[model samples]
Target: MSLTAGILAGAAGTTALNIAGYLDMTVRGRPASVLPARAAGELAERAGADLGSGETADSRREGLGALLGYATGLAVGGLYGLLAGDRRLPPPVAALGLSAMAMAASVTPLTALRLTDPRDWSASSWVSDIVPHLAYGLTAATVYDRLTRL
Candidate 1:
């Protein structure tokens, strides 16, 4: 429930999410999602940091996406800890709520910026998004629950 615990749990959760996403990609032979990286690159450009040439720019963009993802998880996890107080929701329910909240946090902004349009997303796209977030939520909630108890 503490801020430190939330951040540590969030980092773990984000790692789990990445594993789940990579597993899905391996199983389905799908390419990694480019939207987050692209968004990061755009943000960097807006911030005036010319990130270098072609492949280097791509690498930096990917790193930025990952950094942002972990940051988002830490922030959201802190919110969960703050809101849960002394009593917490059942793990399963909390996980789902966390997932939904993360999705809302992400998709809403992307949609507003026209970086992504969920309306145009295919079933597979939805699956890709949901699966990783579900992993993140489950791991986050479980870790937070354990850490708070300790």
Candidate 2:
């Protein structure tokens, strides 16, 4: 039940994050980041899997990248569920912690793979990264709390 709740919470959070991202893009007139797809391609290559070349490869990378994001969100939520385990952190604390965790989960791998360096990000870049994550954390924590109470 906890796991189920966490996953549902994660889905809600992921949706919120995506919406936030799209909103930011609309507001700023910025193009979507291709880092996710690039990360997917890199990981696939390391694992000895060929995604092939050309448009089909690009399509595969994009799909796989999105799936990877979903997988990360769900896994993080699951871990949060297990760790939280009938204990409720304060709302602010929960949100901050979850956001930090999500950010780290998403960024650390990219950093390790040399795809991005958060340290080099500008203020706008930070804002772009953080806003959606904040949305994710707030929504996920709230949903998890609500679901666990049922």
Candidate 3:
């Protein structure tokens, strides 16, 4: 596939994955609302600390940054699939790669803020967070494959 084809396919895949995640989070009664003001404020402060002197928090910038991240992930994943030379890289490996990519995307919000460390996660954390990532990966691959095959 060409770059454009890869990107379009990836955008569709990621959007589907995100929709599924949003629905699952809703069903599980997870926090759908944005973080509270106080938490957001703290996070902004923490994120600002690494900036050079005179740096300050910009909520709009942070939000834009998050948007860029999603864009980047879609681009990266699509290119990766393209470079794999066959969108048909065996199901198991594709599933695992997709799972890893999804998890990488999932952890971005916190990781971007240096808020949470995956290595510090507990068994339950792995089960709850990681398992969902795996499911999303499998689902995303299935969706992409189905679409491209048509």
Question: Largest lDDT belongs to which candidate?
Answer: 2
Q: For candidate 2, lDDT tens digit of each residue in 105-149? A: 999999999999998999999999999999999999999999998
Give the candidate number with the greatest TM-score.
2
Model 1 C-alpha lDDT per residue in residues 1-150, reported as the tens digit of each score: 377777777788788888999999999999988878987888888899999989999999999987877778888778777777557689899899878877777777678767999999999899999998999899988988888888
- In candidate 1, list every pair of residues with a backbone clash: none
Pick the winner on lDDT between candidates 2 and 3. 2
lDDT of each residue in 1-150, candidate 3, tens digit only: 445445655565566556755766777766632322223545556677432222244454445445654675576457655675445767778667877876776576556666677888787556566665566566556655655565
Candidate 2 residues lying further than 4 Å off, grouped into runs, are none
Q: lDDT of candidate 3?
A: 0.58
Q: What is the lDDT of residue 3 in candidate 1?
A: 74
RMSD of 1: 1.5
Give me the runs in candidate 1 sitting further than 4 Å from their true place.
none
Candidate scoring better on TM-score of 1 and 2: 2
**Count of backbone clashes for each model?**
0, 0, 0
Lowest summed lDDT window (length 10), candidate 1: 1-10
